[model samples]
Target: MDRSPFPHHGPLRPEQVTGRESLAVDLAQRIADRRLTALVGPRRFGKTSLLKRVAADLAAVGPQPVWIDLYQLTSMADFAAAVDRGLASVVGPVRRALDSIAATVALRIGVLGVELTRSPKYRPDPVLSLRNLLGVLTSAAQRHDLFVVFDEFSGVANIQGGAGVLRTELQHHFQSLGIVFAGSEPSTMRALFSEQTQPFFAQADLVEIGPLSDAAVGHIVEDGFETTQRHTGGITSRIVAFAAGHPQRAMQLADALWRRVEPGETADMPAWEAALAEVRTNVNAASERIFSLLPTGQQKTLRAIAAGGSIYGAAASALELPPGSAQDAAEKLIGNGIVRRAQERLEVIDPLLADWLCRRFPI
Candidate 1:
């Protein structure tokens, strides 16, 4: 393909996706066993790309798989329409039933969109429509071993009573179909399935997507540069380190660097600095906004973590945070998706972000 191996513009194409062999095997196993699985992580960490890749893999084999992006849904009608569209390819009674429901549901759109009209004998309320939709979807999958993937599932939680409604709908007969839910928001995704009083508590297996290895990302960047005949001594690894193992950031920084150098030329400090500056320009505003919203304690904790200090025990003293507040701050940061538990200590999720914070509020 005539594209950067390290993608920056958008989600990676199937051919460009790399370094996910182990994750793919685990996902395939879960699908084969028909277990409800969730892929959870911070935003921009390639969760959607991975979900697409896995869904595409299964669809290529046999049983048809349907992918619904919940981010685009607004009302219950949108939800019902999504499920109906997904099962349109099924044959016989289930397909007919889904068609009937679609025909009955009152939905309309016009230019800026073409007009769509449907008429049927009976129409159900939004709540019952959702319940019935799941019922028919399960029926459709039973006749054909189906895989249904809900991407950006975290968006559903934003709708009023959405979690409860979904839990009720799928409680009875979802086991027949292989389902995977993918979301970028870690805290909300965890709460949906982990809270004891919640409807889906302990229902799906949680797959936490951690940061990529510096080595893997570094290799990808180095290879991309070399493919373009642009050489780099250690600028590539530095980019990986600055991105803090986040795949998208690493790829993005690498892609930006590639553009600054010409073919058959070496990428020196000037090219590296220019690339880094571009990343800073693009990411600084958002990083600053996120940092500004934190309270004094969290801001202190963030600075400590961003500065790469041992933020667990005695290191709290370095942050000038009172004893035990560091832990609380760490928890808050984790909940906010600003940082996560690494091998032993907590680390900021985005290295470039850490640099931004460090430069903003020097500790």
Candidate 2:
């Protein structure tokens, strides 16, 4: 059997990743130069994959990569544990120091290689533990740079004084550490870094990740099919057009297309349609759940935008909504990262969700 060319889940390999090469290279170089960066983008837009590429590029010559994912963390204890976990995963000098410190504290490191076990009588303040760990790691940075990537860094908002704790601890290490704070929630991320009252205000440079180019998506599609002895038969362009440069969606459509054709078979019009049907079927339940969670006004606004109807024009009137309400709904959608302004037109950020909207509520 031929190896599958498309990855269905998780971050793509650093070399296998496409469309974000230049951006990744630039980010890696900046981090090596000891710059703090805030990387923001929509969920599943390959932000993690880009970070992985950055990590790979910096591995041999620059700081050691320490990845800490803060998604769904509920307290400072969880945050400290996450940091400990990330540190435990590192090799070389950092890992050896962690082992020695864990022994001294009566704690255990390298349990299952990624888990840190706390001693019953040796509980320390979570915030203090986090600060001490950073102190140790950043101290080591004087000898070997430490590049830290905090994925879903905005989730820290859920922990009381989380941002303050991080800011106070990390500020002192600016000269020695390279940090990239990344999150998928655009509005929350903006509030954390851009708002004057926020603790991280002016702390890091901002970088926004957008969709991949259509040409790049097409290249991935063609390469995947041709390498597997299957021909696209001119269907690659249609797949690219529908995917609208979304990194995951492009690979998803290509995978669906690949499943429809056998070795040496050409994917013609019928095969393309069948693949689309399959893709739609796979995402139907998810789309419905997302649509059901929206407010009525947002639902109406989404349908109008998906159908290419004016949100605050006759479409709003027909939906029995005032122009202002439509505008508010559109803005809310944009803030939530569900809809975006593309070329001065409102477009749904998720092309699959947009397709579901139009199909579920026809114009």
Candidate 3:
């Protein structure tokens, strides 16, 4: 309806964002206050998009925000290098911004981190290297206040005692930089900050990034349809409701429905239903492909969660499962973005997938 078919192929840019205005303002405030905030939610819930938008806003206000995508980095060694690269554009242009000699911190970060990448002969102090890197960033922060955001950082940021060390050190030494740890995996994020033994324990405020409401998404759909002079006729409301407010899927299903409509035409109930079936069929098939790949008890757990039942063991039930097994399955489910913890209970994060699971495997 928007002529571009909702653009769900990737995350939207800052100007392209619709709704979630209050969340944006809150994040901006936390960043400016130099408070560490964990942005946690399910995948494709717009975490990266919000981070990018916040980064742009932080830069505008004079804190030189460094956005580092840690998705490609699986280890602390990789983090040091990627972080240096992320800051190179801003920190590289100057020779001696700080009082120290330019030669002191002028080394290309990749080269400094190269030893960690070597096969056999490499021996380097990871903690010292990380300290030096942070020190350099601290020096740069003097000129331009630093707002560092590690996007999708769970991969490397959960390095057991290693990340804990970094967090402790930063809290002690670097008070000038505002750091934001953001990821799409809700379970992992919760464990990172909520667990008493974890590195980031109780250090940051937890911001649960929930899905957009049905009515809000409806407004978005109507706006998109109006741009193309097409009438939505309540079809968008149905699609958004089916999508369960997950932003990406809602937009994607809306896009899928729009493809069935001719130019200058409004979608009626019948046309919308047909398109919904087509979209659901594709989603179900894709989900089934991975269904067998999950752990043995996981399918049962998925069906249980989909059907709005407890995944834990029950003395009164034959489908009862061990607590350890249930927790394992829950971890995988949350990691895959299929389920998330809503307060104390677990629920399917994707509504369409939940409906599909319920219909295909009623428990």
C-alpha lDDT values of all predictions = 0.74, 0.83, 0.73
Model 2 residue runs over 4 Å out of place are 98-124
TM-score of each: 0.85, 0.93, 0.83
> Where does model 1 exceed 4 Å of error?
72-124, 311-320
7-69 per-residue lDDT for model 2 (tens digits): 768888988888888888879877877788999888789999999888987886656798888
Compose the digit string of candidate 1's lDDT tens values, residues 204-275: 999977777777787778788887777876787688767777888888888888887777778889888888
- lDDT by residue (4-36, candidate 3, tens digit) is 648786678877676788888899888888888
Of candidates 3 and 1, the better by lDDT: 1
Q: Candidate 1 at 27: error in angstroms?
A: 0.5
User: What is the lDDT ranking, best to worst?
Assistant: 2, 1, 3
How far residue 97's Cα lies from its native spot in candidate 1, in Å, is: 8.9
Clashing pairs in 3: none
Clashes of each: 1, 0, 0
Model 2 CA RMSD to the hidden true structure, in angstroms:
2.5
Which of the two, 2 or 3, has more TM-score? 2
What TM-score quantifies how close candidate 3 is to the native fold? Answer: 0.83
As a whole number from 0 to 100, the lDDT of residue 86 in candidate 1 is 53
Query: Of models 1 and 2, which has the larger TM-score?
Result: 2
